[model samples]
Target: CSTFLHKLQRKSNRKRSVVSSGELHRNRRYAINPLGHKWDHHNLTYRIVAFPNTLNRDDTRKALSIAFTKWSDVSPLTFTEVTANATADITIGFYTFNHTDCWWSPLHPCFDGLNGELAHAFLPPRGEIHFDNHEFWILGKSRFSWAQGVWLNDLVQVAAHEIGHALGLWHSRDPQSLMHPNATYTGQRNVGQDDVWGIRRLYAADKKRVCDPWASTSASANDEILHEKNCPLRCDLPLESELPPRHVPRWLKWSLRCGHKNLRTTQNRYKTSPRASRAEGL
Candidate 1:
């Protein structure tokens, strides 16, 4: 079985080529490395520092909270948003100016020197998520909802994907998985089964490795361990609580109730730039 690192090494040695539509096609069909293993439990708690621009702060926090809650449901993992001074394992921030945006790096880098992955996250000891700020950043409750226009990937959706990496999930071949490189808004509340399984596997594999300071194992060993502790041996419980429907803001509900024709005709006066996608090549 080839590990993620093994694949990376092989890719690096190969000639760098333009990521033609052909490359994207190959990537879509690319299988999950038979080598990547489940996560071993480390410290189950993580801290995130979300730096949203003042204009978008409220929406950013709301979206980020929803993203965090998605993972908490799958495992014993808990998350907290902290101030800059707080001791945290993970720090998340957004870019306001497009001058230094790195979001597109996963897709295309400046020079010929390119890394062929979408997002890359460090294991436990290294915790940070840097998103490219080059793209527009939009938030919820608008005309056409998530159904209209150019459908550049959704801000909240991208955050949710990167957050999966922050928690130790590898990219999944399952297009439905949140871990997939490119994703659009699906209006789902949680990670898909494939994403959950991948993260759960990480928890089990990483737990022991993180605790055993004396053990020196490679990615191959971790992969082997995960294959042995596969999904059939696991059990999952549904934890999503039903939220009581409260009267939402009148205008917001009215917008949804408005006929599709009206929605298409009305330009969104509330239209704002969307947040850039998080593209750290896996």
Candidate 2:
């Protein structure tokens, strides 16, 4: 493991780097890291600049390999490891404090020793995934260690989430999606449909669909939505009920919940001048 001084030195060399320091986007569904900072190509390369001391190189690589696979299974993108990070598009590391920074640094001032701010990543074209060395990372079935009184962060799940940011994704509000900002260590690790659309919206070639996010919802579905919820005109639900649907696009649900005015506001934000991606902390 080495200082990310290597990453800082090469700042001038990246194609279209992202800073992740702009205004907040909508708090629901999936977001492209603001300013639409995505990898322009599907085939990308990554490098692991550091690792946890508890694990060996081979095991750590395998964990990260599975994390990248979660994205490749649903998108046209691909990731290859390069021993030389200087040529790699994305770089991974584990750092404790000011030597490295992320979207989360402002709140806790880099890694908050122990359970807070487990990790954060930069958006695409500046793919830097940094993990917290303070937390005990594991590739196990459970997330917390009651015996040890600490959170046992799953390396694979957290890597997948950071990889989402590296591929130009923002934190999603859909609780079931892997991109959700809050559920990273609570065992919601699967890539949901929101996660799939978030990636495809960034890299897909087909541009036929209209930009209206709510246009696809018919009057019938809208009626069903309104009738199903007691709160007419508001899509509010208890946290326990925000499960992602099997075949529905997340926008439809967002539209139904937010109503026309808020939906228009959200659409306007995208239409306005682009800002950098927001810091998505865990």
Candidate 3:
């Protein structure tokens, strides 16, 4: 769940989007979509509907595989790639600015080339993830060369962040959690305690309740989520909680435009503080 404001500054006007990537806070817990979106089953399948030219297929698969494991390691959720004729539960692709029709359902914002709005993904059931093809995606923890003009964005890190969205996780208030929206493009990240709490709670609640996925969506307080009041009934309920969080207001996008700076020395690169932009869709 990172945002164009992630430059994800989430790039969408739809209410279902959860564009991410900004902000940090003390050790806190994670958050779920207020509307309540999540998989009912622990075993899940995903497929690469599209792959980026910037990365080799083998490397891309390798990276994404590791990223999915980050979640499975902390929860009962298991992810398997579906390459055969069968349709997968989740799909991933990369697109540039205005590649998809904005008027259509599940709408999202156009990519802005380099900085803001890095990537966005849909919450559960829709299972779609999109990335900006324009960025310089790379493998490894985090390293960039001013001379080579390569401001490498880590595929593993960003994919992991977006995967959280597909899993129905919103941005975590915890700065170190992999679900944190800000400072994503800068380096490698792992699942933190806050994230574990979120994922576990989501599925745990899922098993204990009865939901009606087709129930017409309605509105109430944010606390209504995860309370097991209705076990998040209504296939598409009143809330379609999200992450990667496209589908936010346009004005918020401007505020989400944050960047890093002044890494003048390679030795001190790790010490560079990322811009503290507001975490979108939090």
Candidate 3: tens digits of C-alpha lDDT, residues 1-282 = 333223332333133433222232233356777668899887899998778878888888898898898887666578999894669988888777776553353435667777666678888888888888887777777567698686678888888888988898877656777887673843438887667767766776323222323211232233233222223211111212222324444232222111222223434122111111223221
Ranking by TM-score: 3, 2, 1
Q: What does candidate 2's lDDT look like per residue over 1-282, in tens digits?
A: 112422332343333323221232233366665477888877888898889865667878998999998988666577889985368999988787664544444422466678767777776677888888877888754466799998777888888887887787766657888877765655777788667756766764212222122222433435344423322112222111122344334433332222212322332232100011111110
CA lDDT scores, all candidates in order: 0.42, 0.59, 0.61
lDDT of 3: 0.61
Worst 10 residues of 3 by lDDT: 268-277
Answer with 1 or 3, whichever has the higher TM-score: 3
What does candidate 1 score on TM? 0.48
> Which regions in candidate 1 have their CA more than 4 angstroms from the true location?
1-55, 96-121, 141-153, 185-189, 205-282
Deviation in Å, model 3, residue 239 alpha carbon? 37
Q: Listing every candidate in turn, what is its Cα RMSD in Å to the true structure after a full C-alpha superposition?
A: 20.5, 14.8, 19.6
Off by over 4 Å in 2: 1-28, 84-86, 101-109, 205-282
Q: For candidate 1, give the lDDT of residue 165.
A: 63
Per-model TM values vs. the true structure: 0.48, 0.60, 0.62
